[model samples]
Target: MPRYSSRQELVQEMRKRARLFIGEFEEIAEQDKDTLLADVDRSPAQMIAYQLGWMKLIQQWERDEQAGLTVVTPHPDYKWNQLGPLYQSFYETYQDWTLVALMAEFEQQVAHMIDLTLSFSEEEFQQSGSRKWAGSTPANWPVWKWIHINTVAPFKSFRTKIRKWKKIKNGLERIL
Candidate 1:
């Protein structure tokens, strides 16, 4: 993903990648959502859940900061180095949700994230350390970078994963 110069560019990419990513889930059978493939690490359900986790976390961080609380970079419970467990926690968090529900919630969260992005001014998007929660990283990344990483970047990568999973699943079906 390219560096977003403005919030509009960021939001545009968010919607574009998110649409493509979520669209792939339409072909995934609900029963197969949790079916892990030999190649792809994440099931269809896990992929959506991971997205929801990050979207919600970003929203929460902004909410906390707005409420005048010191914001934690990722989450209060997990440290930067413990991201593996953190991701597992995300999987567990939405494990019971049906794939449809997960996708619906992800869509809603994407819209909310877009709204949140629009809420920020161009100056905030461009300037590093604009948001305390966002700047806690060593690089002091701008708000747009955080948004791009959490949204557009992962959406594209996860889309590829799901596509690969789909092909693998189809191949297995044919062989069996």
Candidate 2:
């Protein structure tokens, strides 16, 4: 029998996948601990490593929403300048069953997501698609963060093609 189909089942599945992904991260991280991974191998590790971190963040956010938690929208400010040292640390702890400091840092961010669920009202969600999305789970459709996208999308229309303004469209408007 299939183990899961409902929401709870799905969350459990995601957690399980996260665990497995961690295992893979350790496998790769161990291999490179003593040396820099070639460009071929290193970049993917970086990407998956980063995404694994983000998955934890997104899931914690989802759990809060499921429980009707409330807060404001969140800006993406988790990572900025620190990466090289973190990667070096990962290389230092390769192949261990235990977590490297980078993983610990990621786990800490996940915990913060729990604390900072970006709580918002339904109205706020309508105003910003991402406010609603911040609470969504990966089990659902992959979230497309539209927080950066304005509520009104700017797309050129047929009118743009047809309209020709007579020259004096002055920057300063006439007072009538």
Candidate 3:
């Protein structure tokens, strides 16, 4: 896990990584967007759907906690151990969506996250226990960590996955 010294740093990193992640999609052809890679089960559009789904879930958790409701990490019906099913649900939720529509929704969610991040105070961003729903296992993470894991970190990782998917589709040499 990475730590941020300030909210600006977190916001900047989130923007940079998200831009890099979303930029990968521009290089992909519309027809290839739905093609599944042999090594990965998800199509490129489905991958973006998964990321968007998680972002929405995090927002819901934050909203629920702010309203003084019990926050369920991941989801209410699903536990940490049930992530596979949860991911399947994400895929199913966006299965009918076109790539263009998914891209528009992804951009909207990222903008929403950026706005949400900007609204946090320095203390709320850095101090642990700022959000009770964040949980205490493995130490209580500050709000920034929650934002990083759900946004920046996953964007960096999923960017790599999409790049690898592109290479595999083109029968090019693997970069790694």
Candidate 4:
């Protein structure tokens, strides 16, 4: 639903939101990184891994589309409605990773996303139906929408989740 007039605006917004999102993790203690709040099913580490997984998936979609291959929206083995299992896969893939390592990998992925975005021309960036994997049923989406959903929207949403977890955890700690 959001629109960007230029690639620079899109990139800037993505970077800003991502920085704020990742900054939330820096406030959490290393030991508390895995603490699952009462209302939240995922720990900070799991959330980071999920973000990494989606970023990688988006990048892969771009690569595959550019190569003239049929692009799958979520993945070959997973459907849009099957995200729970896909998320579980993300957790399993990074299960042995420490919070610090996960964060570093996330940062690297963000950088890679930025680079990929920069490679697109303005028309390619804003053109509707630019990528077939973006879907065509209800309405065609511009490439910017795809990038925004994968980056900006999730960054903002997950930042709030992490903040909520910290608040609840800290509140519980004080109560105890």
Candidate 2 structure, TM-score to reference: 0.33
Residue pairs with backbone overlap in model 3: none
Which segments of candidate 4 are over 4 A away from where they belong? Answer: 136-138
Task: Provide the lowest-lDDT 10-residue window in model 3.
Answer: 167-176
Better of 1 and 2 by TM-score: 1
Candidate 3 lDDT, 1-176, residue by residue in tens: 78999888988998899889888888777777778868877789888988898889878888998898998777898998899999989988988887778888998999888888888899988998887866634568888888898899889989889988987877753443
For model 3, state the Cα shift of residue 60 in Å: 0.5
Q: How many pairs of residues collide in each model?
A: 0, 4, 0, 0
lDDT of 4 by residue, 40-104 (tens): 77899888988899899989998998899988768889887898999999988998888789889
Q: Which segments of candidate 2 are over 4 A away from where they belong? A: 1-4, 27-49, 56-99, 106-131, 134-176
Q: Measured by TM-score, how close is model 3 to the native structure?
A: 0.91
Predicted structure with the largest TM-score when compared to the true one: 1
Put down candidate 1 lDDT per residue, 1-176, tens digits, no spaces: 48877888888989999999999999888899999998899999989988999999999999999999999869999999998898999999999999889999999999999999999989998899889988898989888888888999999999999999999999999999
**lDDT accuracy of residue 129 in candidate 4:** 70
Better of 1 and 3 by TM-score: 1
Worst 10 residues of 2 by lDDT: 150-159
Ranking of all predicted structures according to TM-score, beginning with the best and ending with the worst: 1, 4, 3, 2
Candidate 1 vs candidate 3: which has greater lDDT? 1
lDDT of 2: 0.35
